[model samples]
Target chain A: MNAVEAVAKPAASKEKRRTFDVLEALIYLFAVMMLILIVYPIYFIVIASFSDPAAVAGGRMWVLPMGFTLDGYQELLKHSNIWIGYKNTILYTVIGTLISLAVNVSAAYALSRKDLAGRKAITLFFIFTMFFNGGLIPTFLTIRDFHLYDTFLVMVLPFSVAVFNIIVARTFFQSSIPGDLWEAAQLDGCGNLKYYVQIVLPLSKAVLSVLALWTAVGYWNSYFNALIYLKDQDLYPLQLILRNILITNQMQSSMGTGEAAVIAMRLANLMRYSVIIVSTLPIMCMYPFVQKYFNQGVMIGAVK
Target chain B: MSQSNAGMLHTLGRIRKNWGLYLLLLPAAVLLLLFAYIPMYGVLIAFKDYSPATGILESPWAGFNYFEKFFNSYQFDITIKNTLVISLYSIATFPIPIMLALMINQMRANRFKQVFQTVTYMPHFISTVVMVGLILILLSPGNGLLGNLFRLFGAEAPNLIGSAGMFSSLYVWTDVWQHAGWDSIIYIAALSAVDPSLYEAAKVDGASRWQRIRYIDMPMLLPTAITLLILRIGGLLGVGFEKVYLMQNNLNISSSEVIATYVYKIGLLSSQYSFSSAINLFNTVINFILLILVNQAAKKYSENSLW
Candidate 1:
């Protein structure tokens, strides 16, 4: 096929010299349409957050902010619990990412070694949980038995190492870092820990960055753990707090009536849009910076 | 006997030599045991009449009482029907991302491709709580963007979130919106790995753009697609509990009550620990069986398998 194409290239080029084609045009059109569909809701939320609550509720606000006001943000910021949620979430993400990365990366490195005794068994031990689990009740029982319920550590400690992540990292180590490198390091009297820390760690920047971003984002957005394990409002992450607000608003809008109902409705409308922005702003801001690494990271992890 | 002894000695020597590596694995092993394996033992509580005072082990045996109760309960048919419907709905939407990736891959401009990819993948990072919140806000019948759009066209917007009929579509489509771009990443990666020379050959053969895609790109993407499809089918029953739980309301409970959410309600809220555990165990068993069967089928039909 290559030889045939090489011989026919000149003739084909002469006939196919049209710069634009219907297919190309259609592809571009589809891409633009999808871009709008994907981006418009997010854009709407941002604009809606700034619009007046009544205008927003009345369907007046669409492409632009209607009767622009910071009242929603003002009310949200004034609520001290949102600040506490932020503080708790930031702490969880930071500490949890570090702990997760350490546990996952080290485990991955160890399992990636072909010479490691019982490597296959160890990997199976981890992967088995992906298919079947104890389900919700038993897991809750175990957490309670460990005395981790309502504790801050319950948020960060339990469920720290993701098996999927470990597998991805292990696959990365196997493919990217050659066996010869480890052998070479051993020849230079570099012990396992030293070699891993100095050489392997430095060389694995892309995977490490990907793992860090994934772990950090997961911890940042997680609400399920907080919902199940932590009952104390003081320890609640931002998602839980936002969730409470959203549910309350939904309840109020559906049930409430009279003057107080009207007031509650407006507040609910404002908070609905504002809370979306508040909860997701940090992650959305960080996404662009990490977008470049995502392709590389996802490819490495997903390929295997 | 000598060879077996030598193999044992080799394993022992390796363990002794790489003690540090074993030490590194210690924390993960311990954590997995405590959190994953220990809870697995808790699944035994399903077979027993679990009492908080007696703990999981000491509870008296109830044989198949809880399981029978769940199978015979009124919630049984509704929950299973809802679970299968939603799961099948989700599976149906799986190819949207593939189509998106194919469209993105077809684009000639590099800059547009990068921008489109970045913008589309952003939603995957949004928390489920926030995602549902956005859905509620945007679909709010009176004041939401959907309502406003309907009004612009001289019609009232249906209460989309409140309508039982719309629940599954809303859930599936919102999921597609949130995850399609992120999911497309793998396909894009797969596409990039396709041999460029194949495209050149097809071009010289006077193949149209559609023909090139049909003959060249589709073949290259099929293996990855099949592997992913098998994996998706394997976990067909394991619909995410978070978003569904968040989006669930009294109006849409008929369509939204999945096994996971039902289990949470029964086990945690209603305190039917044994019954919920039995339900969960049943769900897990079905999922495991499906996974193995799918994996085996993929292995037989295609070269790609998860194993």
Candidate 2:
């Protein structure tokens, strides 16, 4: 209550504030370091793609492209497999996303209905697969027996029923779409299919888009299915093509000794950087914009 | 008898009314039958001397013979050891994402927090193929980024990607880098749901920042973290096949030959269908048991569990 005591209290709290400031500073420092650690490698790849192979090898290029050239991209463009991969991946992603959304969203909605008969049994039927399944050999054999192997449909159809996506979408419908809405639709003489198509699908765009993006990304980046099922070169997706170029050491080659072989090898190394940038560019560009939608899916799941 | 007949008729009426719903579910049910259920039925081949020519059903019975072969094989110990080592190492780093989430929650500036999260989560969009490719390019001992940096110091860059000793570390840490930020999203959502009044109450009590995080934040994130940990433990042996298969070379095969990859190589590449199916059957059974055990333990110990 006294002026002297009030002044002393102010001085003591300021001292506490100073230590708090130090902790705040340390937190900021941690964030900045993590930012650098993640962004730097990606930045390096972008710059390295344009830089001359020799300069990149000599450590001359770090922050900026050193002795910039379009040689890597030029060489990559010349590879016909890369073009085939792009077309195949794009086709697969679009068709696969549509199939996934149709099957999962419909199933999700059907199960979301409290009045739907056998909802619990149907949901359990889907969820049980999540916990246990026959491993790869049996699955592969089944696909082969179904005659889906080595076909384009193999990429999109067999793996359509993603249980996790269905669960998330079902949660979204249960929580967001009211049971009264279905009752209202029924009173208006709308069938379950009509209500789902016209009303529910239109209203559930947020979750639908999120599921679509996830499925599309899965299809785009998929190689294991392609690797296992398809033996034809023409059927390969971008990831498989990238695997051959970047990991499998199957770079395009010509039989030439000494200097010519060395040039070919250097071009191959330089192409690795370009190939990564080319393949991942679309996802990276689209990610920042749609990042919130992906988070939306997580939040929906978390609430469940 | 009359009461039972009435109940059965009522159930039949419900099914007849909801026939459209069943129609909607038909595609998914059929897909599951083909891809999932049939594979399960096909797993019976593990107990048979599976000849692809004879098909899964017609394959002659050879109960436990292939299982015995796998148990007696030299690969049994090596594959199991490698799978466990990688999985346990990954689980050990599980706290990193929780810690990152906690740190991000402490930030005073909203814009900086968003930028930090976005940047960190960016790596996750990079596919497994590109990710392993980046690993090779950045660590290639001859002319990689590390190689170039080492040359500056007149020292040789060790072959990290191909090194048997570094296999697990490289796999786990790169996975951490790619996923920790994305994983933190769930915890961050959990943190955001914390009532601001709780923080105000803590501040009024003269609790320091660390004290607030300890008393308030830690308790809030505990249920979610425990649930995630249980799921992680349940799928302990289910290490992904993509990244490991991509990263494996002849040099590091000793440490990188996981159950998933081993099955792929054995069944598909070598066409030892019965042997590979048996190994796979064993792996799936163990994974399912672990999941059930962990879920049960969590249900008993805490309120949060996967039911």
Candidate 3:
């Protein structure tokens, strides 16, 4: 279509053309600049992570790493905190995601059923909580009441069943699974559980994968739960570990750090960038695998 | 009954008989009610000063004392103003990603567009603390990369995260750069739904690339845009405390001290739980108001809303 514009517009006008050429050129110029503006920080961080921590902080580094070294990675790896953080985060994401799927899928299946009694009320009860919360303090108190304070389970249990994921999954099931398929299974003496397990589960991986990825990323990035509930540093996830490093860095920098404190502070800053790369690397790799599910066509069974 | 069951039972009949779904949903329903709904009760402490020792049940009601305390504080108006101002500036620039998405959508399918999107989504994965740490490192005066670049151009390099003047702009624009590509996925998804037949027809009717986008693409995207807008407004007051808190240094606290962080400082750091609860209560109320207001606006304008 744009090709036709090039062919036809040339023969059409010479006077409406001068302003048009300049504007088109300018638009292209701005577009390129915007791309650079969006991407430069990520580039800057990656470059700095490989550079000499001191040199990077001093503003001598840019697109290329100056005095390139693996010192940051070495320092980061040596810290038990970093390792613990990684372990806790992985556990949280995996366990949290599994529970999330179980709850979301089962409840969604129940909600999708035409014969299920009180389905509307159940859906509303779930959706209503999303709209109004009793606020954070109340939520914290509830966590305390459950005796989940400073426990690893607190991190995963609170977000087990998200209404949004449930609704999306419910929609996927209701629309994609033909009633005839379930009828065929039931005629062969299969019950609801057996039919769902044998039929619905197999057909729902597309939307399920999307939900799983969403939950994993959410659990991986979660720090607030740790911040409020898990006060013990040993239970800290990667995000909380990184947050500690940042806080300590700020404190050292402010209190007029001695030589050792300066070393710690510099290493902390370097560790921050490297940890960003490390902690985020998992989910970044997961996106492409599930990218196919994030479309209306996929949910609408266009693929079949 | 025997005849009704023996004639032709189907999938619907099986579901009608089975109650095992209750077992499946039982764990999940219990967890949500315990964690999400139950905490809502603690919201009452906003009106009380019950210590952990006293416990919730025995704690006497303070009767609006905390609310009054929050209202009386000098930080009250400033925090509210700053929170709204930051969100306003952010909502103003929300179009950048949207426009970028439109541009990407306009291009014919190619690998370059895919590559551009992947690169843009990278920063969204970076944690808030690290993102701020990178910004501080990259913009630090004598040793930072961007700082040296500015120095090379013969201008004094500014400490971006440290400067009060640059705090809001830096925070919001950095957000745009990091998540712009990721967030644009919805808009791109919406764009894909526009019927190719409409574009083919528009071509026959003599519409240019820009014209087709201006008329069809923009209008087609309205519902998605408005739906997202309502959601965004619902979260207007609930800015990420971690990002803002990490970004804040003494120099920029004047601009970076938002309501969420203020509550954190008072509650967690200062140990004034009641006062912090009051501040948080205030933030939540204002957010509720904005959510309703924005949803109403979306419903009026586009006949779309979250509810």
Ordered list by DockQ, greatest first: 1, 2, 3
| Residue-wise C-alpha lDDT for candidate 1, range A210-303, written one tens digit per residue | 9999999999988999988888999999989888888645855767779988877787678778878888888988988777888798789775
**Colliding residue pairs in candidate 1:** A57-B143
Model number with the top DockQ: 1
Q: Model 1 Cα displacement at B96 (Å)?
A: 1.1
Give the C-alpha miss distance for residue A228 in model 3, angstroms.
1.0
Give a tens-digit lDDT track for model 3, residues B201-268: 98779877678889999997787777777777887888878778778878888888899889888877
What would the TM-scores of all predictions be?
0.96, 0.95, 0.88
Q: Rank the candidates by TM-score, best first.
A: 1, 2, 3
Ten contiguous residues minimizing lDDT sum, candidate 2 chain A: A248-257
* lDDT, candidate 2, A140-170, per-residue tens: 9888878888999998889989999999999
Q: CAPRI band of model 3? A: acceptable
Scored against the true structure, residue A206 in model 2 reaches a CA lDDT of 86
Q: Let me know the DockQ for model 1.
A: 0.74
Q: After best superposition, candidate 1 residue B109: deviation in angstroms?
A: 1.8
Model 2: lDDT to the true structure: 0.89
User: Looking at candidate 2, what is the lDDT of residue B86?
Assistant: 99
On lDDT, the stronger of 1 and 3 is 1
